[model samples]
Target: MDQKLTRQAASRVPRPLAQALSVVEEAAQGTKLWCGVTAALACLGGRRGRRAGTAGLAAVAVAQLVSNGMCKPLADRPRPPKGWIPHDEVEDRPDSSSFPSGHTAAAVAFAAAAAPAWPLVGALCAVPAAVVAVERVQSGAHYPSDVAAGAVIGLGAAWFTRRSPRLLRRCTSRPSP
Candidate 1:
């Protein structure tokens, strides 16, 4: 299934779209795109930007940690086979497990985390985040399952970050067992 899907994507996607996806992929490497957005928010967004930026970054960090540090090391899956991807960039795919996509993870985490604090900014962020997810598969760096898992991890991280304070309050408020 992954092979056939990748083959169709490689053949069917337009050249301009492929190029655009490459740009998005490069910007997303190691969350550089997100850092730039967060910086802009913190600088020009006033108090609301600061809150959203902080929350977004925190969630991204957690998502990256869980996706890259823990999950990648445990899962032994690899990048798509070379013949499946008819792109030159296939050679650039990382030699690591592709069970989850760190880029997608960070993107979703940032968008999800920021949405509650700044709805407009979060909506804007979601566009690129969605692009990042597609780029992961279109680039042949990950299968669709990898992107899905990464998105799940990202959402989980965002949820945890958003809820941790309240959860802590609940835990602390409880009487000694």
Candidate 2:
């Protein structure tokens, strides 16, 4: 069922849409595009925007580490079959394990983390995040389950980061130093 769905989604992507998604996929390389977006928001949003941008970037970093470093290695799942993708995109496909998509993780993490600080920015960030996730499937780089897992990991990372300050305060409050 997963394979069937992935194939169906990949096949239905039109050339222009695929080209656009390919650009998104490329920008997501190493989460550079998202970092840039977050930085821009920070610059434009004042103090509150800065805070949200910082948190969002932090969450993205954590999600990348958790998804690519830990989860992907552990899962060691293969990417979707090459034949499922269009010829032009074949070379753009990553060679790494694909259980949890690092790109999608970073996207969702940024949006989820940023939304708490600035609802408008957070809401805005969601658009690209959703595109990145769908692009992962549309580009034939990941299965639907891979995108889902990445989203979950991203949300978890954001939640953890949000709670870190409280956790640190509790730990330090009792310290002798």
Each model's lDDT comes to 0.91, 0.88
**Cα TM-score per model:** 0.95, 0.93
Q: Top model by TM-score, which number?
A: 1
Across residues 59-142, which tens digit of lDDT does each residue of candidate 1 receive? 999999999999999997988888888778778888999988999999999999999999999999999999988888887889
- TM-score for candidate 1, residues paired by index: 0.95
Residue pairs in candidate 1 whose N, alpha carbon or C atoms collide under 3 angstroms? none
Model 1 lDDT at residue 151: 97
lDDT of 2 by residue, 32-121 (tens): 887788678778878997898899999998999999999998999999888877555655777889889998999999999988888898
CA lDDT, candidate 2, residue 29: 83
lDDT of 2: 0.88
